[model samples]
Target chain A: AQSVTQLDSHVSVSEGTPVLLRCNYSSSYSPSLFWYVQHPNKGLQLLLKYTSAATLVKGINGFEAEFKKSETSFHLTKPSAHMSDAAEYFCVVSPIAGKSTFGDGTTLTVKP
Target chain B: EPEVTQTPSHQVTQMGQEVILRCVPISNHLYFYWYRQILGQKVEFLVSFYNNEISEKSEIFDDQFSVERPDGSNFTLKIRSTKLEDSAMYFCASRDGLAGEVGELFFGEGSRLTVL
Candidate 1:
């Protein structure tokens, strides 16, 4: 079984400040991890994915995440937060190709 | 870019009525999935389909829930009897299944089901 835990339910940051969202996972085997963002009333958009290729993955909108195996963590980070970045983010773990487990989600609020 | 699309953005139904949610996945995608999220809750996976059969499903997908790919393009989820608890936003997602491809899912806007 694979599961992901998002440490924070909500996080607020001022514009131009660094942003961090924490996630941890438990999987039986080497797993595939992903970060997805969902805006209000919109579908989820893939931010980035870790497929055991790179320890640090860069994604769109200046977002990035580092995959740490020992710590079982894949935390999303951005050098600076923008108002457009305010949304709900999910950490997902997949044991196989099609099945996925999503974290509770972290609501990000960017204040201008 | 090609994207998944869902129909009936919102539906209101009386309890015990059957509701079917429809989706059209990306043309070349081979894997299809259904997920649901209650208001303010985490998204939950309901089922995954490949080769016109279910590959995996969650415990929440009970006897009352079923899925089908009736045609080449349409994927549908049918709930036999709706309950108030079933009210949520149902999302349909698809993934390109090329071997060695990363497991990235493309999602539809979702259908909001309201069981009254």
Candidate 2:
């Protein structure tokens, strides 16, 4: 069984301030972790993924996440938040290619 | 930069009516999946299809739900009878065949089904 948990349901950050969204996962096998962002009326876009290569993964839109095996955590972070960054973000865990378990999304609000 | 495509972006139907959601995955991709998000809820896994067969499915994929890969490219999910609770945003996704790398699934815009 595989599952993901998003610690925060909503996060508010000021423009140019830092952003953080916590996520944790449980999987029987080696897990693949992903962060996806869904802008309103748009498809879910892949922000980053951790396969087993590097602990630190950099994604598009200036976002990054670190895969911590000890903690079973994959937390997303960004140094500076932009207005455009406001959206619903999901944390996903996959035991295999197509089989995935998604976390309740975290809605990020960037205040100007 | 190929993308997944879905039809009938939004559909409203009466309860107990049948609904068929269609999708066209990336040409070279070998894995496909269906997921749904109820209003303000977490995205839930429905089913996964690979090699012309269902590889795995979640408990949410009950007898009322069926998935098919017809004509090689089109993947479809059919709800035999939809309920008010079935109303949600359904997403179709596909990933490549590479087994070594972390499979990155590309998603469609989603089909919003509103069951009345």
Query: Model 1 off-target regions past 4 Å?
Result: none
Error of 2 at A101 (Å): 0.9
lDDT tens readout by residue for model 1, A1-112: 7789999999999999999999999999898899999999988999999998989999999999999999999999999999999999999987657688899999999998
Residues B1-116, candidate 1: write the lDDT tens digits: 99999999999999999999999999999999999999999999999999989999999999999999998999999999999999999999998887765568889999999999
Question: How close is every model to the real structure, measured as TM-score?
Answer: 0.97, 0.97
Worst 10 residues of 1 chain B by lDDT: B95-104
Candidate 2: which stretches are off by over 4 Å? none
TM-score of 2: 0.97
Among the numbered candidates, top DockQ falls to 2
What DockQ values do the models have? Answer: 0.73, 0.75
Which prediction has the highest lDDT against the true structure? 1
In model 2, the Cα lDDT at residue A5 comes to 90
**Candidate 2 has which clashing residue pairs, if any?**
none
Instruction: Judge candidate 1 against the unseen true structure and give its global Cα lDDT, from 0 to 1.
Output: 0.94
